[model samples]
Target: MTSKKLQVIATDKAPAAIGPYSQAIKVGDLLFTSGQIPLDASGQLVEGGIEEQTHQVFRNLQAVLEEAGVTLNNVVKATVFMKDMNQFAIVNGIYSSYFGDHKPARSAVEVARLPKDVLVEIELIASTVVE
Candidate 1:
């Protein structure tokens, strides 16, 4: 069996990965994006509460998705990590605004800590445009 080459997608709208990782990975027809914190395109965490941070996270995800030839509509699943589950309502409200039409399977959980101590982080699994 032949293996396909790994494709890396990078975007300026999202905070770049702090470690040795690409913003998103393309393997065949699937695109896997790394967890996105509330950092802006300039790689600085947005100064705000959970609400503003959530919005910035979505924007970052959007940039990565578009870079990989996909949109939020193509997302099949999402994993949302939060330092406090109590902020679910606020984050959900913002998340819903991004994908008003498509509803992807998602799981949200409270983590003890996140990189850079951001209030929220989101990662996604999406399907690429099938060639």
Candidate 2:
């Protein structure tokens, strides 16, 4: 069996990974992004409530995807982590606006904590070239 090469991707649009992890990894045509927090391109957390935070997370995803030469359309799956389940409805609403055309497989879970103490985080699995 041949091991796939891990391709690291970086961009100015999302916050840089705080630990020993790439913002996203591309193996072959697939791109797997790290969990994106509510941070801006300059690596600062966005302000406001969960809705705004969710939007920033999506923006970060967009940045990483663009860096990988793909769009949200190429995403096959997504994992959303939230600090509180009560923000589900609001987060879903904002997330819907970002993926206006396609529906990807998704799982949302509430966790006890997140990096930087952000309210929400979003990670994605996408393709380099849309099929």
Q: Extract clashing residue pairs from model 1.
A: none
- Best-fitting candidate, scored by TM-score: 1
User: Residue 108 CA error for candidate 1 (Å)?
Assistant: 0.6
User: How far off is residue 105 in model 1, in Å?
Assistant: 1.1
- Candidate 1: lDDT of 115? 96
The candidate that wins on lDDT is: 1
Cα lDDT, model 1, residue 118: 90
For all candidates in order, the CA lDDT equals: 0.91, 0.90
For residues 2-121, write the lDDT of model 2, one tens digit per residue: 788988999987888889999999998789999999888787878888988888898889989998899999999999999999989999888888898789999999999999899999
